[model samples]
Target chain A: MKLKQLEGLLGNLDQFSAPKIELEQYPTGPHIASRMLYTAENSFEDVSDKVVADFGCGCGTLGIAAALLGADHVIGFDVDADSLEIAYLNAEDLELDVNFVQSDIRNLQCRGKIIDTVVMNPPFGTRNKGVDMDFLSVALKVASQAVYSLHKTTTREYVKKTALREYNAKSAEVLCELRYDVPKLYKFHKKKEVDIAVDLWRFVPTPTVESDV
Target chain B: MRLLTHNMLSSTIKGVSNGFPLTIEAAKVVEKQVDMNSDFLKNIFSKIEWKPFVEAAKTLGFSELPEEDVQPSLLDSHEFLTKFHHALLEIHLEEGALVCPETGRKFPVNKGIPNMLLLEDEV
Candidate 1:
């Protein structure tokens, strides 16, 4: 299926009844999800036949779309049961096979199976500083191949530095940018929708030993 | 929790290194017939560790899975695939406790969802 079509389908997925602000639970827009998947497909080892994980999956957008796009298996991890409830319903509605796990990312662990790729939009730590790093740490640990995460553009230096220095990540790059629409879910926000600059980062664990150039 | 999910889960409690393959103590196991997709089974085959999967299956009382050395040739075998299907997808714990290998902390699985939450102090 084309990315545009998948985005349209993802748009129809059930949303949170009452979105939570603390978790920074703004759903990943379908366009971003599409772009992420498109990059994973053409550039990274295609998600097809791979074990893909959606970290901090809000309403199962990334994970569900991956499954529909032929990820051999997809796991959607979210702490909120309400969000997961909607995620599960959305999966059923789409008739897609996805396992929605309800748990905090910091507390969750994966064992017998290693995740091939992770796609997530973790909190930018606007509310609680450094929480985004927790998501990054967990994603790094779970993924065997690569991680794609959305973060505040201002945090590029810290995230990139930490990705390389602390995690021994071999490759790190800003894949693209998406203008994030922050809906008025919190009291601090006076506007109905606020736009923020977010950067998409791709980090991988191992360096390619053979360089063509 | 589906063993597929179980295969990807470990205990993350404090000071518990090697928390992988959390031993399953299944109080309740559920068997539902999900449509078999051989391609997906094949795709996920490499990711599923053999010993833990066999042990987890046996622990839950689905003994049809072969003991060891699941041959690549067997991956194509319908009979083996059927058994593989049962162990991997069909039988999953509905109510259980995933006991940490090191810390012995028991993460409870209620209604097929394992609560992997740690107390704030544990972090």
Candidate 2:
């Protein structure tokens, strides 16, 4: 999608609202917020052939972005019904095929289907601390390989250690991080800054498949 | 499962404050195809935790991530976006076991599914 198209979508932000089922409502900034998805899209360019899952997919942004970038299929999971509705509409607007499901990240069951990759922008826990880890736990459970967004300050070491232990996944730091420029309410201020430093982490499962001898 | 979900899970065996970044002992892994939706992604970009996302992708053998410091305009490039999408959404962990950080609890993953069930004692 062209930048103009994206800009147009953002222009209509007022039309978007939290789904009635959403427990909490949050604003996603237009500038800094979308950068992470762009980064994620860059991260997945080479491996777009795999099935992708967007966990804690608020409004299905990451998942939708993956689809736009080239993933053959994208599945988005979230607990908020209102967000899911917006996500679904966004998918339709973009003319991209995506699957959005309303489910909690902590207690999700994927049946038996393994996805190629998983991407998400889970809760940061500013309002609710310790919630980001919950999103990560679910990601480790479902994906063979995955990438996630995290705060630069507190979660750096924790993210690395978690990947190492859970998926045997390693960490490679990305150069450009998205620093939130302002508080959520005053996000439009543009001058105010929140500095939500972001990092893109990759997780690959150990190869258990035996090669032909 | 997405890395975002993995970051929060821990072996809740009684009182383990730092049960995070569960270790994955994947026995089998697979990758499937899915659709794309750019508009949706564009919306959530600011909210993502990119650092850990990159770290997790590397563990999955996806080392090709752009520099975090690069400007946003770079994201407009198809070449850049494609690679980002692959790492963020492609690699899959079909089956594996998740070991808790604090406790040596092993959660089994069957058929690309993780059974995060804890035993009576562990719980």
Models 1 onward score TM values of 0.87, 0.53
After superposing candidate 2, which stretches have Cα over 4 Å from the reference? A1-47, A172-175, A186-193, A207-213, B1-123
lDDT of 1: 0.80
Residue B83, model 2: Cα distance from true site in angstroms: 30
Residue by residue across B1-123, what tens digits does model 1's lDDT show?
567778778777777767778899999998867667788687668767787888899999988888777867778899999889888877868788888788888888776667677778777
All-Cα superposition RMSD per candidate: 4.1, 14.8
lDDT of each: 0.80, 0.57
The DockQ score of candidate 1 comes to 0.47
Candidate 2 TM-score on chain B: 0.71
> CAPRI verdict on model 2?
incorrect
Give the lDDT of residue B55 in candidate 2: 66
Q: Alpha-carbon error at A212 in model 2, in Å?
A: 23
- The fnat score for candidate 1 comes to 0.60
